[model samples]
Target chain A: MESERSVVIAPEALDDLIGALRRRGFRVLGPTVRDGAIVYDELDSASELPIGVTDRQEPGSYRLEERDDEARFGYAVGPHSWKRFLFPPRITLWRAKAENGGRKIEEEPPNETQLAFIGVRSCELSAIAIQDRVFIGGKFVDRDYAARRDGAFLLAVNCGEPGANCFCASMDAGPRVRDPYDLALTEMLDGEHRFLVEVGSERGADVLAELPSVPASQSDVASALAVTNDAAARMTKAMPQVDLHALLAGSLEHPRWDDVASRCLSCTNCTLVCPTCFCSSVEDTSDLAGVETARERVWDSCFSLDYSYIHGGSIRASSRSRYRQWLTHKLGTWVDQFGTAGCVGCGRCITWCPVGIDITEEVAALSKQEEKSHAATA
Target chain B: MATATPSELHPVGAFVPLPFRVAERRQDTGDTWTLTLEPEESGFAVEPGQFAMVHVFGVGEVPISVSGPPERPGDPIVLTVRAVGAVSGAICASELGALLGLRGPCGNSWPIAEATAGDVVVVAGGIGLAPLRPVVLHTLAQRDSYGAVSVLYGARTPADLLYTDQLEEWRSTIAVDVTVDAAEPPWKGKVGVVPKLVATAEFRPEAVTAFVCGPEVMMHFTVQALRERGVPDERIMLSLERDMRCGIGLCGHCQLGPTLVCRDGPVYSQADVGALLGVREL
Candidate 1:
């Protein structure tokens, strides 16, 4: 492991580096500026990248801004995530062609995957962790996710420019990549935009050997640290730290909920943007001739009314209850079961919330008011 | 929908539609239909409150609780189904002894061993009683294991009451309290809902653990009443009813937030449902 070290890639020859990756049978995917926002998509060359692009994000709002510097690792999360590439929203679980009255079952052929994700933030890695628990951790693993996860590799980029909506620093997920990556890149794009690449696994080191990268000097390491430390300290968005699980579980009857519920659109944008939210609906498709039938699982949300339907009625029939369920489970009770906070505190819920309902703010308010009431009683 | 070729049994998570013949159909009320299925293979083993995916090959599959007993685990698994959607409607419309597909006796059931006969309260509202029927049967069979048994049931109206025959038998043999939302002209039973009756009914709170299954509104009210009566959230248990399409905990249709209703529960206490209780649409 000590022999596995960092390599410094020159900024001028970034395209040559991308070519090296392509030659090694890696379909390099990364953040590219598209439709006024930085989107994660397939990048064939360095020219397709978000070279001089940045982004602006707030609670329920997002905007893109171009940077004067020709740096690539200058943004946080955008509309596109690695989930689309790995766990697609819709994939053929199985397909059948109906023949005669009885439907014949056939094997669904598996597809090959050779993706190499670039610039995955730490929080996104954590998100991948959550997804792994769902798809791979269970007894019946999703074979498709398994093949994709195993075949594809990662190129985790350290966050040099944090978006306004970014809360990876607060969530303890990033500003850097820590786990589940092949190569973790510290984009020391300050003064001179060069990459400090750390090979996490054997595959990463093998990829590094192909690129024209130099052994990093002490100053290069220090320069990379300085860039990362600055961004970690400069994270703009935060939710206050309260015992999230306890606070949420205790405040079942808290009246502040009504105030928040009034503004929540129940549009499910928070969940859609959320990398950890994995709820899906099952659909059975029959052929036009009405012989063969196929069943599929598609992404579903708690916000939908039909999700809770039983005999004649739906259990959770109101928006308020749905919001309460999503937030409480994400922050509170999830700890008791999954042994971790369901939320990585990405601030996507805060920013993508059409109502600007910040979870951290709510927990803080609850704590403050409870303290006040207790003092009054005392 | 990319569907697999319909195989006899699927791979570990493969969707296998187990075609069974509905040998018997019993209508306890105008709304609820109970079917006894005879699958080609035996060993349709399940516990009380666990559910099975009843499929109409052309229509779709819906999750209905296994209200049958463990005594006859291999014979035929009984499903007390209520008409709701296209698939359920198809099953209801189909003749007795009609061919149907079954997938599972999925999810955990009520831990009957946890409840002693000291004093057990079985509360059901409308068709919610169907899921609890197996527990009732199991408890009745093992009469000496329990102390005193009482079943409290509430329905929309006299005409809406389900399992009328079974309720009559339980009334004669066990301590039973049946109520309706509104009493009819000839109705001599309790007029109020189940919660109002349960709050006043005396039972041993120390030794008693309640099994309450009902509409979401009724269960909430019933649970609140139980908690107010000094029963711990853990003691006062309720089975949730959700839109279960796969019934195998895969489809998010049965999820109440992160808790898979088909897996973690259809049975939850106030402690479990509290997070989910706030979200009405969940």
Candidate 2:
């Protein structure tokens, strides 16, 4: 086991870390400015990061703004998550071709590359852990996901500023780095513009031994803790927790569902942006020659009416039922199925929703309705 | 972490469909056909009430119940498909010697051990009878273990009724009563809904275990009538139908509230899923 070690690295030495990972043959991915928002993509040097930039995010709104100081990691989650790279939106499971009056089936060739993710927030790390439960920890392990996960490396960042929609503190998933990462870094720009690096795993210590860094002083560690605690105190949003599982489960018939459904467009933006949503659909298509076929699995959202379609008609014909299913399944029944809440409180669902349907607000409204019903019953 | 169980019985991922040679295909009604498929490899057996995701070559795939017995492990897997949709229609049009893709023997099975000690009543409606045909066959094969077995079925018309020959052959050992919603001039038989036949059947409510399958509306009424007869909720089982794409729990298409019908059940006791059945658009 590798003992915990902390060090102080100047802002300029960040390039050495990127170079070290590249030397290790890892395709390093980090946040960069693209399409007027920060998106994760290939980063060859630390200069590619969104330097001196912060993002303003609200329900159904996101915009990049220039910060007074150079904060390399100041944004919350973007529209895309790490799920796109891990459990890709589309993957071919197998292929088949016509043979002598029969068919010959072949397993899909395994495809995975060595990956190292940089600028990963604590909430996103929790989201990754949630997906780990679904794809790898379930009764039947997803072979494709297991292969990619085995060859991946993670470098997590502590959140020094929480977004307006973020509630990771309430979910107990963020504002502080708790889970194991290859390397953890906390940016301290208040007095000295330097990063406090904490080595977590053996791989993290190996990389730290290569970089030139001095031992972190007591003040550096204390300042890093202050940064995370300040972010936790700054968050304005929170999830209501008055028997939330039972509240959502029993409130299936609550009239507030109709109100939310009326505002919802059912465009499937939430599920697409959600980090922990794991529902998918399979499609089998053949070539124009009519001899070859390929079965592919793609990400699917419960908001679609066709998601529940059978021989007769759609099971959830109304948008009200669909929205209710999405909410209760995420916050309530997910605990029953996976032994954890489906949400990691990254706030991507709220920030990317088209009609500004905030989950925190909706859960609070439902909790209030349950309280009123309880009072009346009493 | 440890890898999953051995690969022979359980594959790493449960999505791949293997090829099964269609040894024989017989049309029972105008739109319904039964295909007995011999797998290229042996050791794949299917129990009653389980289903298979049958791929129709270039078209697509649909879930059809295995309406065959599991008495022998190497016996051909049998499926009865009704050509109501595009994929099933393509399946019904396939040749006898052609090869189709098959995935499972997936989902839960009927509780034969419990039903054997009590009186069994099998109720079905229209094409919904396809999944229950195996239950009827299993009960008769083990007739000595059960008491006063009965089968009550209903169809839209005489032309829509499936497995008439087998239904007639089973009459010597068990009480088989069938009805139709409408009939032609020369037809002389019972003409009403399926639940009405349940009222006229001879079985002790306290000692009976009923299995019902059919269209959603028909199943709703059949469960209501069975409850009125004083059959306890747990004693009545129903095989449900949904848009099961993956035929596994991974796909969220078949979820009904907390239950994934593909995994938790296509066969659920009325007591387990009764409250959810009548909930509108749930």
Best by DockQ: 2
Scanning candidate 1 chain B in windows of ten residues, the lowest lDDT window is: B1-10
TM-score of chain A of each: 0.92, 0.97
In order, candidate lDDTs are 0.74, 0.85
Q: Which ten residues in a row have the lowest lDDT in candidate 2 chain A?
A: A1-10
Pairs that collide, model 2? none
Model 1 accuracy (lDDT, Cα) = 0.74
For candidate 1, the TM-score is 0.85
Per-residue CA lDDT of model 1 for B18-46, tens digit only, reads: 66777788876776787888765554677
In the range A301-366, model 1's lDDT, one tens digit per residue, is 777777677666767677777777777777775665455776765667776787777777777777
Off by over 4 Å in 2: A1-4, B1-12, B69-73
Tens-digit lDDT track for model 2 on A216-256?
A: 88888889889899999999999886677888878889999
